[model samples]
Target: MVLSAVLLFGASSVTSLNGVFAQDSVDEISESVGDTVDNAASDISDAVTDEESESTTQEHGEMVHDDEGRLPGNIKIEREPTYKVGDDVQINATHMPGMEGAEGTVIAAFDTTAYEISYTPTDDSEPIENHRWIVQEEIAEAADQEDADAPFEVGDEVTVEAYHMPGMEGATATIDAVNETTVYLVDYIDTESGEEVINHKWVTEDELATLDGAEETAPATSESTTESSEDESESEESSSDEESGSESDSTPEENSDEESSEESTPEESSSQDSSSEETE
Candidate 1:
C-alpha cells in the first residue's frame, strides 16, 4: 500500500510540471506574436507618414530651389531685353506648378539658347518631360562644343550641368526643343503656395507678357469696355424713349386745344344769330 501511494504521488507531480511547461510555452508564443504585430504596425505607420510627406511637398510647389541650387557660372547677359529688369510681367511657363500665369518681376536677363529636355532623374524618379529653359551653358557637351550658337538638335543626348531640380545634375538628358532668345531671371509669388520665389532662372522672352497685356487682363478689360458700351447704348435708348414720350404727349395736348376751339366757334355763332333776331 505504501509503495502504491508513493508511485501515485510521483505521477501527479510529473503531470503538474508538464502543465506548467505547456502554459509557459503558450505565454512565450503569445508574447512573440504580439511583438511581431507591433513591429508590423510601426513599419506601416512609417511608410504612410513618408508617403504623406512626399505628397505635401509636391502639393506646396516645393520643387524649385532658386539660387541655392547649381547655376551656370558664366552665362552671357542680354544687354537689351524686350522685358527689362524691374519690369512686372506675366509668366507663361509651365516648368513648375503655379509658374504659368503667375505675375513676376524681372530680376535679370540673358541672351542664350534655351533648351527643353527630357530626362530620367538620378534618384530613380519618374522621367521628366519637356523641362524648359536649360541654357546652352548648362549643358556640359554643348558648353565644350566649338559653336556656342549652334544648339543641340531634338533627340540629341547630352549631359546636364544644371541643378534646377533634385537629381537633374549629371543626368543624361535628350534635347526636345531649342529656342534662341532672351531668358530672364524673375521673382514671383507661387500661385499654388502664395509664397514668394526669388531669383528663379530662365524664363524665355516669348514666355513672358506685360502685366497689362496678360491674356486674363485683356479679357477683363474687354469685358469692362463692352459693359461700358452696353451702358451707353441703354442710356441712348432711354433718352430716345423719353423724347418719343414727350412728342406723343404734346400731340394729345394739341388735339384737345383744337377740339375746344371748334366747340367755342359753334356757341359764338348761335349767340350772334340770337342777338340779330332780338334786334329784328
Candidate 2:
C-alpha cells in the first residue's frame, strides 16, 4: 500500500510539472506576438506623420502672386498734392499691410484723385464679399470708375497679393476692379470685437503721390523719357494689330503666289484632289 501511495504522488507531480511548462511556453509566445504588433503599429504611425508633413510643406511652397501683385513687404501709399499720370514716386500711405515703413518703387504714379473700392471674394466660404481698397479714375483703365471692382464686372482674373485674413494670404483671389478713386490701407474695427484690420487697399490717383519720390525735383529729362515710353507702347500696339491682320489674311505674298499657281495648274489641283480621295 505504501508503494502504491508513492507511485500515485509521483504521477501527480509529473502532471503538475508538464502543466507549468506548457503555460510558460504559451506566455512567452504571446509576449513576442504583442511586441511585433506594437512595432508594426508604430511604423505605420510614423509613415502617416511623414506623409502629412510633406503635403503641408508643398502646399505652402509655391506662392507666385502677392495679395496685390506688389512685391513682399508692407507698402505705404504716398499722395503727391500735384500728382498726374507717369509720375515717379514712392508710396508713403500707411495703407499697405506689412509696409507701413517699407518703401514702394512706383510701378505707376498718378496725379488724379484715388478711391478705395470693394469686391466680392471668389474663394468658397471667404468672408470678404466686397473688400474695399483704392482706385484712381485717372489711373484706372476700365470703362467705369464707380462700378465697384471693375474686374469683377469685366471678368479679369487676379491673384491675391495681400492678406486680410489668416490663410487668405497666398490664396489666389480674384481682381474685382481695375480703375477707381483713391485706395487706402484701412483700419476697420470689427463691430463684434473691435479688432484692427490692416487691408493694403487701393484708392484713387489723387489718393496717391504727385511728387512722392525722394522729395527732390526731377530734371526735365524725365518728361522726355515718359513721353518716349508712351510712344513706344502705341507703336507696339499698332504693330501687333498689323501682324494679326496679316496672319488672318494669309501672308499677302503667299496668297498672291497661291492665286498665280492655281491659274497655272488647274489640272494639277484636280489630280491631287483625286489622289486624296483614292487614299481615303
Identify the leading candidate in terms of TM-score: 1
User: What is the Å distance of residue 28 in model 1 from its true position?
Assistant: 26
**Cα TM-score per model:** 0.57, 0.29
Q: Residue by residue across 1-280, what tens digits does model 2's lDDT show?
A: 9999999999999999999999999999999999999999999999999999887544433211123444223222446523432334344444333333333323333232332333333454434434434333212243344652333433443444344333444344344544434333322322323333323344344334544343544655688889999999999999999999989888878989988888979888899999999999
lDDT of 1 by residue, 224-247 (tens): 999999999999999999999999
Worst 10 residues of 1 by lDDT: 60-69
Backbone collision count in every prediction? Answer: 0, 61
Per-candidate Cα lDDT values, in order, are 0.86, 0.48
Evaluate model 1: give its lDDT: 0.86
